[model samples]
Target: MTHRLPVRVYYEDTDMGGIVYYANYLKYIERSRSTLVGELGLDQKKMKDEDAIVFVVVRVEADYLRPARLDDELEIVTTHHAASPMRWVFDQDVMRGDELLFRAKVTAVCMTTEGKPVRLPAELRAKLT
Candidate 1:
């Protein structure tokens, strides 16, 4: 399944050149992932409070194919690419209309509050699939 979230680039998201700062794409995809989980009915706060599990980004591989400027309305698309016992890999993309501006493979791991890696709960994995 793919989850899409809309984002409007603001002045703060731009660099001195008036193009979106590279780092802001990371923030955009991160927010999209959060919304994706919520739409999947995975309440992260409740998971942390009740089950002691929280998700953390472990790695990211991104490619910037095109630049987005201030006021550009973009769409962030997120989908599960793969999953292991301890991590889920997501393929996320930033698009403006039919143009692909950026893409990334983000790996996130579930961990205990103490910060040890943990297997994703079976129920949550099922929900993701």
Candidate 2:
């Protein structure tokens, strides 16, 4: 399944040249992943507070294909799949209408707040698959 999130390129998202800062694309994709988790009925806060479990990004591979300027309306498209019991992978794209601006593959691992890796909760794993 795929998830879509709409985002607007605001003044704060841009650099001195008025184009989105490269780092901001990572932020945009992070928001898309967070939203996807919420839509899947996962409560990150609850997981953190009660189970002491949290998801942390372990790696990100990105490519910049085009630039996005301030005031541009963009959509983040994300598709997720499980990589292992403790790892989840997401492929994301940043688009302005039909134009692909950026793409990334992000890997996240389930971990304890103290930083030890852990298998994803059974319920959450079921939801992702």
Candidate 3:
């Protein structure tokens, strides 16, 4: 399944050339990840209070395709690619209408507040159903 969220390129998200900044693509991916977790009924506060765990991006590999200009309405698409006992992997893409602006593969690991890797909590694992 695919998850999508809409985003508008704002002035603050651009570089001097009025094109969306390279690093801002990662921000959009992050937002989509947040939405994905929220839709799964998992959030930071609940994770902290119940499982004492949090998911953090351990790695990301991205490719810049076309450029997006300020004021362009974009959609961020994310797919849950794989999951293991302790980690999740996703394929994400940023698109301006039908044009691909950027794409990435992100690996996130479940970890405790102290940064120790942990098994995916039962609640999160259950939600994958």
List lDDT for all candidates, in order: 0.92, 0.95, 0.89
Model 1 C-alpha lDDT per residue in residues 13-100, reported as the tens digit of each score = 9999999999999999999999988887888999999989899999999999999998999999888844777788899999999999
By lDDT, the better pick of 2 and 3 is 2
Candidate 3, residues 1-129, lDDT tens digits: the string is 589999999999999999999899999999999999898777778888787888889999999999999999999999984478888888999988888889999999888988899987677777664
Alpha carbon lDDT at 86, candidate 1: 79
Give the range of the ten consecutive residues with the poorest summed lDDT in model 1: 78-87
How many clashing pairs in candidate 3?
A: 0
Error of 3 at 57 (Å): 0.7
* Highest TM-score against the true fold, candidate: 2
Best-to-worst ranking by lDDT: 2, 1, 3
Which of the two candidates, 1 or 3, achieves a greater lDDT against the reference? 1
What RMSD does each model have against the real structure?
1.1, 0.7, 1.3
